[model samples]
Target chain A: MPFRHLLLSLACFIVFSCKNETTPAPSKATSQRPDPHSLADPFNDKMLELQLKLKVDFDKKILSGSASWSFDRKEKTNEIIFDTDNLTNRKSDPWERRNPNHLYARTP
Target chain B: MTLGKEETPTTFTLEPRDSILGSALRIKLSPNTNYLTIHYSTLPEAAALGWMDASMTAGKKRPFLFTQGQAILSRTWFPCVDSPSSRFTYAAEIETPDGMMALMSAKNPQQVSPDGMYKFEMDKPVPPYLVALAVGDISFQPIGKRTGIYAEPSMLKKAAWEFADMEKMVETAEGLYGPYDWGRYDVLVLPTGFPFGGMENPILTFATPTVITGDRSLVSLVAHELAHSWSGNLVTNATWDDFWMNEGFTVYFERRIMEALYGAEYVEMLAQLEFWELEDEVRAFGEKNPDTHLKGNLKGRNPDDGVGDIAYQKGASFLLMLERLTDRNKWDEFLKNWFQANKFTSKTTEDFLAYLKTDYLEKHGLTANVDEWVYGPGIPANCPRPNSTKLAIAEKAATNIVNAIPATKEWTPHEWVHFVRNLPKKTTVETLKKLDSQFNLTNSGNAEIRCAWYDTAIRRGYVKEILPQVEEFLVGIGRRRFLMPVYTALKETGHVEDARRIFTKAKPGYHAVSYGSIEQLLK
Candidate 1:
């Protein structure tokens, strides 16, 4: 499969006719989350794998299970963070939000 | 059933985080602790789980339990790093009540287990948002070799009949892109109040029964969800910011599938309607609203807030423009290979741009206003204008309606929607009555056309006569797409009391998601 000559030329023509506002070929860090939505820094110790087992309790409308999360440490660290609760869960579940950084003081 | 903050497990802690709805669990890293585990149970009011009693189901004798994890709700159902970026393989053994069946977004069982314990497995890794579960007194009948339908016994035959083209849709999509990587594509026709139109849960697509209109006019939604098998379930957008990566690609692919099955003119009607929807939404969002951008800013806001017609329509329009830029043959090749190359991985908008440049643009000696399309606010000026010769005929007929002319007869629901959309503002009560008598739109069985006519009726201040029909439609269906505008229209037209009364009646049937959206609107 290939691009036809006439169409390819037409595409290039449109590009040159434009204001040429295309930014320089995006750098390696082209993918960005300057203001990241996630609180957990997956990079510090990347989660390599996970296994979850849950039982649905229809009467009580609860699912009870344990999730086994496996990850690798990028560098030796005394502690790690896992983002686990949602603040909007005020109505559904009983939980509270403290901070985005360390939920509690990191220990060595 | 909730995990207390103070009672943190020795291995990790489930604590709250600011700037969002859900909480994150922090687990301490240990050399010996290669796998850390947390035992958690979902609350009855868990966001992901929708527990419907026998009264709420089609069978009216069996309970149904389903999970919706999109945007960020999986954590409420099960303990995991509930993020769209974290892809993981999972297996589950759900213990259902006797005479029930359980299904997951995985390899599923065709029959109900004797003891009610059903097991499921998914070897391919998927984000938490794609995780889904449905349990009920459901039965399945194969529609094609690798396609089928699953519904409660009452809806089984009807659902199978409606989605009879499931096998052909898969073959058409595969012919355009690549083979259907997921083993089988099945659909679970959920009850009326199942919230969204469809959730692209890997092997089985959780769909609203609203799509079972008997006429198959709305099966395009099924095509849209099926296209997700490649765009979303296979090559995924790494973050919610690049949501258009998932939706935009899927919408574009969905249309092509529809075009394959029902010709370009049929698909063009939808594209034109999407353009109209996008225009209205952009204006509603205040053309410059950051929410109107393809790459959305959901910072400190629920990611779901970024979704609207903007993601689906705008994103699709941008891709449509690109396809026209280099022609279909080359564009199909680009997308087909792109899916093949990036299958089963999470990618960002930047990664897509890089791939688009080197793989297609540079290779084909082509360039597009990529930044203007993805990064800019509102619909890009260059978004392709959708036109259909067949739709033009309908549009002409619709245009004549304002001048005492009735809309064309024997029209598809799509054509009715187009006519309803083009109805002149301040159309007199006389005109509404005329259209109603001529079309019987209020009595129409089709939900889409019914809602479309209802919108006009409400705005024309002629809703009082059709009050029963209006209330029934409102209480019967819980699709937020249909619910929001009608409720808003009622609320704005000094009918707050009526809207509240109807919503109150419909509250129990509404999914948590639908309830949340309607509550915010009627608030």
Candidate 2:
């Protein structure tokens, strides 16, 4: 009975180590001062440079463009946030249909 | 969305919108991902963008577009951190309609692009709000080797003549602070509908056509904007709450530049007028209102709410007090060192106070009412009193208009403003009519004088005589500085119906910044 219990404990430890390796690490907390107006966490991940290629449409009064952001990721976060107002994404993604309010509910 | 040059697909989440702050765009990053690109478009009603039809422009031939992004409007045009705390270098390829030129707050092209494709590069890391762009039937003329003017072809000569002292202003400013880091300084004269007097977009300053008063009397607005190169563009406020740091410092620096170029007497008139404006604003907000404090609490509110005379005048008053405490040479040295130390960084109010404590106060072994001036409500007791001999003459002239008419012959715009603003509140409409008929105040080509005259006219019940001119002035100019007082007077004097009517006709032409304030006032 003792030998069997030891073998079972060893198997449990191996399974836990494998799970840890597969899962991504959590991001570390940042020390930068908070900006009440923005939702970006610039201390953790910040954009270093930006490249823009935009076409002006006077008829529509809109600017269609590709904004390429070169960033430095200080932490291990899987997501980087930016601020936008009155802009539309040209490309459709799976999350396009997701309710943003619902996603906000999931956020801390 | 794609990652880097490989164009690998990535996932992003668009958060729910807040009424004031808009929405947040969250993009997923892989373990090794360091770059991502977003493909998006700006909505027509973006608050920062002012898209004008040809009929609204000065030339009345080609359309014009400009952007005003200060105080959290940049996010409306492009996705970014959208906070002064974040700074980055940017490069762009802007394509415009054929025959039009594009300019930005970056290295610009002197001539129009034959193919309507223009490239810009801003190597220095600047706050996102300073990223500006303008496209229109614009032409450029050089004032000096490093200074120039951009305007509609029709207004080019007048604007260039008005701002001929641009090179001198830059040289004087550099003499005071440090080198003008941005390579070139240029001014673009937008259509009459441009809201503010001037926006200090680095490398290029967006000015209103209204400033081109033909006499160059209102060019202090240029000096003010140019001063921002050292105070605002170089050293920024970390958050909107610390906006006084940007504006107050610029106002002080502007006066210094003006004093260096013109003289003490000229700049003193400017300072005196601002002091009166500040006092009136304090009374309007009530002396104890927290918003009057230099270090504002703008959490959960529009930052623009804190941008009245308090930030511009009260903040400068605090600096003036410091200068009076220490000698001018010592203050100048301290300020020069302060700007050099924080050249490209955004600083909060606390950061500044700490720096001052260590660098200025401790070094000089002096103490000041810093807390009372910054965090306390209203203007402090120790505020400096600006005494302008010319303004005193203007005030005396306002007391007796008949005797003062001849004296006004040599009056500058500042003196005119002081005279009109100091007019007796109980003066009869007949007196106003006589004054207007003599001076042609209703038809004054100078916007500052016109705005001041209109405010007095509306208050003293003289609106009936100049009703047509008032409506024309209100509809023609979109500057909030000129619009607010006249509208408020109309409402306060029981003309809400008239105010609403004029605003309905004028709202579409006003930029979001101007209309937003007016809408709140009328509401």
Candidate number achieving the greatest TM-score relative to the actual structure = 2
Off by over 4 Å in 1: A1-35, A44-49, A76-80, A86-108, B1-11, B17-21, B402-408
* Cα displacement (Å) at residue B324, model 1: 1.8
Docking class of 2: acceptable
Most DockQ-accurate candidate? 2
Compute the lDDT for candidate 2.
0.83
What would the TM-score be for candidate 1 when compared with the true structure?
0.87
What tens digits encode model 1's per-residue C-alpha lDDT throughout B11-97? 334432242544455545444344454545555666778888777788888878888988867766665555567777877767777
Off by over 4 Å in 2: A1-33, A91-108, B1-5, B401-407
lDDT of 2 by residue, B1-523 (tens): 2223355445555655666776677766554566666767787878899998887788989989999999889888888888887889999999999999999999999999999999999999998899999999999999999999999999999999999999999999999998999999999999878999999999999999899998988889999999999888999998888999999999999999999999998888889888988999999999999889998887777777878899999999999898887788888989999999999888988998998898888889889999999999888888998899988988888888644444357788778888898888878888888888888989998988998898898998998878888999988888988999899999999998999999999887788788988999999
**Winning candidate number (lDDT):** 2
Model 1 DockQ, alpha carbons vs. true complex: 0.14
